[model samples]
Target: MEEDIAEIPHYKYYFATFKELEDKVDQIELLSDVIGVVTIVQDLEKSTLNSRITSCRNVTIKNVENKELQVTLWGHKTDLFDDNVLKTLEGPVVTIFTSVLVKKSLGKPRLSSTTSTLFFVNPNIPKVEDLKTRFQEDVKTIKFLPSAITTQSSLNEEKKENRKTLVKLLEIRPKSTKDMRFTVKAVIVDICEKDGWYYMACPNCMPPVSQADVSWWCQKDSFINKSPLAWYKLNTIISNQTGKMRMMIYGRVAEYLIKEPCIQLVTNHVNQDKRKFPQAIIDVIGKYKIFQIAFETKAIDNVAICKKVFDDETSEATNNRHRLSPPINPKTPDPKVSVNQR
Candidate 1:
């Protein structure tokens, strides 16, 4: 019985990363044709809309070539096996069911001891390679693919263009100051956002200010009767093999992208209307059509670079600085006492 089980043909496996998997995915025979061991497990509790109904455990598996494949596990298997199976099982295989694509994509994979689709543990599996040459060649092919942006620009120049929209995330870095305005452009690996505003500072003195009651204060004067205004500052950092550069953009140009009404809300006190605060910020930030998707990049998208003003505002050190003076002489401590007592 054991020998017959070992002879049975299981799902064919593909050894590739998620990117590679996406590329050659069409060549895959069927959803049922793919299988591999779970290599990584992700917790999806925080982000999803239906947090209650779904299991948080999602698995990522590495095939023979060390390519990662994300799998969602669900049903009875959620209760049967703990996450420790990933560490303990030398080989845990899963069989794919093509007809089950709808639900399979929704939940993580479940393991069953008897089912061919599920392998509790199997010792026999191939070693993963460092890199797949075939994947590298395919990437090279994609690199030469024609861009629609290029085509659109040519058509516009010839006056033969129709109404068409192009959506792209462009990173702009200040190359140099021209006519008192900074010139910038998109560069690879440099962070960029489409429609976000930087905390506005005064152009004359470049001072940052919080919302004042029904007014805004500059260094010497208060601009009263002015609708609460938040200045949008375009923040960008450009880095390449040569070096890195940081730029802060201001004036009417920044106002055009961020808009006036949204900026007013950021600078105003909306305490009584607490719900509007978060949504207002999101609306202002989201207007930037091209956003760097990664969280790390997004965090610094609209940051303001300003100088610290006062010495008292400095951060204090936690370590003790005082040192006691040592005794003048080892035997001279008996000034107040008798020589016999010493």
Candidate 2:
């Protein structure tokens, strides 16, 4: 097996980026093919009422732009994927999904396998190498700005808070950032676990930063540093009795809500209990909280319409921010001045 494995050659599997998929997904008929590097490949499972047994896997892929799309494969397709693309691993397995169906699942456009769908496990494609070359540059652009922003720029962003609209999750328009004020009175119904709900990042830059050659790199400050100052990117599913949506709470705010740097909880999860969720996340789940939401319809074609949350909490929800923040570190200014708590 070792001698045969070495015979496999590097291949390319190229296809559309998430943005292209998003654009053509609406036409459905026109979305004849889809492709990208699969970052995550989940396990298979079954459900009741169907003796044949339904199997599926959720896949997240990124483009040269670092834009991502979620895809799910079912039944025969899943079996095929597991047998071919997954099993044919000679090295770092690179597979490309092709001729897929674009469908709406939970309000998001996800690619799925159709009768004509095909799989290419590390085929010779130029675009694949192009993707590798561009991935780093794109990560820097999407997750962090190579150049740091001025303190004045930060102040101006804070000033825009007054002009932002205070509305609900259900009322946002596509690409309309102006006059967009909204908030949601939501209860955490479920805490999802695809990426373990939290991500490591740089504090000041809010990084989805990458590590290379045993060193941490932050495109925001263009610096290499250690792990002293870090934060999280939190993901949760929230519901306001009226509707439910996926909410991403970024660092600082997540720190404000979780009450501690998430690293502690993550460490506890890793060293103490691998199967259980961290206590901090458990505490927030099922709790009533208010979120100031931005209505960016361009995201996943209005997937649940809840995006870019500011840390503003409503008085009607709960006055928990105070308890969430530590006494040290610069005191958080009261947000009540600009927002209606309830």
Candidate 3:
């Protein structure tokens, strides 16, 4: 039996580049294999999906060309991470994820492990050694940009002393330079499709990349020849009785409102005119909800940014509570600014 096993052929791997996998994001039936240097591994987390709880972990990897991509491990795959060995390693760790399902989040192409997905950390292969050598030579220059979601969560929360109206929010200037948060009530008056629905961004830095003659150019990182990530940068015109304002919704927030991923929408409507808005986005033109907005004091083009959106149930409950509360005093300003709940 041992002699028979030794005579069997070794397993073969066919790895795909970041560009190749991104092009096949919408092909749900296709599976891909990827290999890169493990740059960041997040702590194990529990999340509910499909009405059931599951263990998941995110691992960020970069290829020899300095292109980064995120891969999520689900179920028992999360236990394959050996933290002790990773921490004690003197060199960069290279991993190969096979038979992964390519998916998109906020326009960025990511991989999710399927039932057949398998991974190897620091696998003994010539390609892995080549990746390790490249990483060692460029370790100091390989700084991954902080995720926008992470930065938004780290921002200081503002006290809900007053719910600002659309007009009031514009008039007030924050004292500090840091981002200031505010709660506001508004309705989606129109979808601003002038900038389209999404933009291609650098996978590592998250900066919007411009299309060069033959490759994508990122101002911070210069020319990156690999495939760029598509992130949701949907803009909408929101309004209240006080006034109207243009608010920017990014990434997951846009996903929450649209109930769809940007990549999927783009793929499904690839033949449609770019100027025309997709039906998924157009459906939210009349939604009335509460938005937690983040105002950047120094921003030139961006006036207001929506962080978290309250659902219909939460918005209605808050409205009811406000109507039942009596006024504190005739001289006191109205703490709650009411808007049409259509």
RMSD of each: 23.5, 21.9, 12.5
Worst 10 residues of 2 by lDDT: 139-148
Which one wins by TM-score: 1 or 2? 2
Could you tell me the lDDT of residue 103 within candidate 1? 22
Off by over 4 Å in 1: 1-33, 43-52, 89-120, 123-342
Residue 179 miss distance in model 2 (angstroms): 6.5
The candidate that wins on lDDT is: 3
In model 1, state the lDDT of residue 29: 20
> Whose lDDT is higher: candidate 2's or candidate 3's?
3
Model 3 TM: 0.51
In candidate 1, position 151 carries an lDDT of 35
Per-residue alpha-carbon lDDT of candidate 1 for residues 228-324, written as tens digits (9 for 90 to 100): 2345454545333244444343533334333444345555644534333333333332111211111122333323221111111111231111122
Query: Evaluated with TM-score, which candidate comes out highest?
Result: 3
lDDT of 2 at 322: 21
Clashes, model 3: 1
